[model samples]
Target: MAVYQLDDELWFPDPHLGEEDGLVAVGGDLSVNRLLLAYSNGFFPWFSFRHWKEPHWYCPLDRYVIFPKEIHISHSMRQLMRQNKYIVTFNQCFEGVIRGCSSVDDRNQEYGAWLGSDMIKAYTELHRLGYAASVEVWEPQDMSSGKRSAKLVGGLYGVAVRNAFFGESMFSLVPNASKLALIYLAKTLDGMGGLFIDCQFETPHLKSMGGKHISYDKYMGILNGEKDVELG
Candidate 1:
């Protein structure tokens, strides 16, 4: 399929026309309305400033996602939860969590970051408008005055539609910290009657945590079916 080039005006191509690698369109501004529109149609922007050279949009033929009911919690993660080793909170530090996700040293890749300043500004605005949200996992710090405080260790941020969470990125400072945050996010969303957590694309790490790939048609069916779920 041909890649559509978007103007400063707000619009997107039909998500079903995406290519194999999921490059559906390019060159659109990251306005909050545009972001919301894209996510509502099962599309998302994912580009590296260095590698891709442009802000590319994608809606893969197959999507990676975790249904709330299918969330997997390992024995070790359960132990962590049982021990209360981490504290999880929502929207407590959205900016900090995004910055941490952008700045963390990713041992997997040697170069660029997808969460550029433009992306950050756009999503920060989304949070301000209550469309985007964040989850933070913190570890306690010993205070000199004998009071206990928690410092940020791991977290994640995503966009929330009516009944679906479009996960953008996540970061971890301690082992399994991000995982703990994920567990909390999934379970909480489940408890609240959310549909699924869209992972966008696939990765081995996400797969290990129970993310599964489904055809875009099926995904859109689920999205539309859950659009009126009234998760709030």
Candidate 2:
């Protein structure tokens, strides 16, 4: 299947026409309007810093997502949560979370990539406009002060459109920090009634947290069935 080449126009090809590797289109700027349109249509950009010639957009045949209410918390994670091992806050440090995610070193892993400077700049702008958001995990600074100050340890960032959340990346400086961030996000979304978290691609970690692979058609049904939702 030939990948569609996007021109100067702000448009994307039908996601169902994507190649086996999920490549739907190539060559497009990461403007806020473009990104928002892509997410609403169940498409997302995924390219490496080494291949910066043109941006590649994809919509996988097997879409992975997690219903907020269905998020699985392991016994260990529950214990840590009960102990208040980490404090989770939303939209606190958008840049810090993304920078942490981009800096994470997974050299020994098969699937590892960094968010290049261009991606960072684009997403930061999105956050400024309120489409993108972040969740921070922190540890207490000093108990002796009797005042609450936090030391950032881990977090995750994503773009929320309507009733869906597209998770971009997450990182942890200490064990279970990122997990806590995810748990908090899930619980909060669950409280908002029906919401979904787009995992994008399959990973063992995500699968363990109850992420499931669904057909693209089914995924679109959920995306299209919703009205524009406020992220706050």
Candidate 3:
């Protein structure tokens, strides 16, 4: 399959035309409108920020997603939740969460790091416009004044289009912090009638947390309100 080159026009090729590896196009500005349109159609930009001058868009035919009701909570996570060692909040710290995802563990130093200054700026704008959100996990820290303040430890951020959430990136500062964020997000979405979380690709961790593969057509069906996702 030929890789399409994008220009100033706001458009994308048929997602089915994407290459086997899921890469469909390799040039486009990450304007808010472009990002919205891309995600609404199951396309997302992911490229090495330092290595590429333009965005690389991908839409995998095999979509990996997690229905809100199917998010798995392991025994360890359950125990941790009972302990109440951390605090979770939604959209309370968008910049902190994205910066943590971008820079945690020296991710920005890695060669294929996708979250950089431009992506951060763009997504921050998206958050301001209410199309993006963040789930923050904070650890309480005791201050010298005999008060306790929360420090940002871990969280995840993603874009939401109606009932579907397109996950972008997540970071963990302590063990199971990101998992807690995800579990919290899943439960919160479930309460609000969210259908699915578009994981974009499969990972063992995500699989363990109830992510599953469905055809792109089926994924789009739920996204477009044309069909309901079957929950197990």
Candidate 4:
């Protein structure tokens, strides 16, 4: 399959026509409208930020997702939850979460770093407009005044469209911090009748937490309010 080159026009080629690697197009600006359109149609921008001059959009045919109701809570995670060692909040500090995600492991200096300055700026604008959201995990810290304050430790951020969450990136300052955030997100979404979380790709971490593969057609059906499709 040929990789399409996007122009100044506000449109995308058919997602099904993407290359086997899932790259559909390249050279588009990450404007709010463009980003929203891409996500609404099951596409997302992910490329080596330092190497690529513009956004590279992808839409994989084999969709890996996590249904909120099916999110796995392992025995260890359950024990940690019972301990109540971390505090979780939604949209409390999106900037902190995004920055943490970008800087962890000095990703900016590494090749194939998708989260860069430009992407950060774009997503920050998305958060300002209520299109994006964050999940923050904090650890309690005692100040000199004997007052307790929470320090940002770990979290995740993503785009929310209707009933679906398009996960962007996540970071963990401590072991299982990111996992805790994901569990909380799943519970909250489950309560609100959320459909699924688009994991974008499969990872052992996500797979252990109940992420599963589904066809793009099924994914689109769920996104389009057709909830009767069977999940794999």
Instruction: Please list the residue runs of candidate 3 whose C-alpha ends up more than 4 Å from where it truly belongs after superposition.
Output: 106-111, 228-232
Candidate 1 C-alpha lDDT tens digits along 16-85: 6768788899988888888998999888997677787778888888889998878889888888899987
User: What is the C-alpha lDDT profile of model 3 across 30-96, one tens digit per residue?
Assistant: 8999999999999999868668888899999999999999999999999999999999999999999
Q: lDDT for each of the candidates?
A: 0.86, 0.85, 0.90, 0.91
Model 2: residue 31 alpha-carbon error in angstroms = 0.4
Better of 3 and 4 by lDDT: 4
Off by over 4 Å in 1: 107-111, 226-232
What is the descending lDDT order? 4, 3, 1, 2
TM-score of each: 0.92, 0.91, 0.95, 0.95
Task: Report the C-alpha displacement of residue 223, candidate 1, in angstroms.
Answer: 1.0
Candidate 4: regions farther than 4 A off: 106-111
Residue-pair clashes per prediction, in order, are 0, 1, 0, 0
Name the TM-score of candidate 3. 0.95
lDDT of 2 by residue, 1-232 (tens): 6789998889998877879988899998899999999998888887576644768898888899888988999999989999986788999899999999888888213333537788899999999999998999998888787887888999999999977889998999999888889889999989986468999988998989989988887787777773443211
Better of 1 and 2 by lDDT: 1
lDDT of 1 at 118: 87
As for candidate 4, its clashing pairs are: none
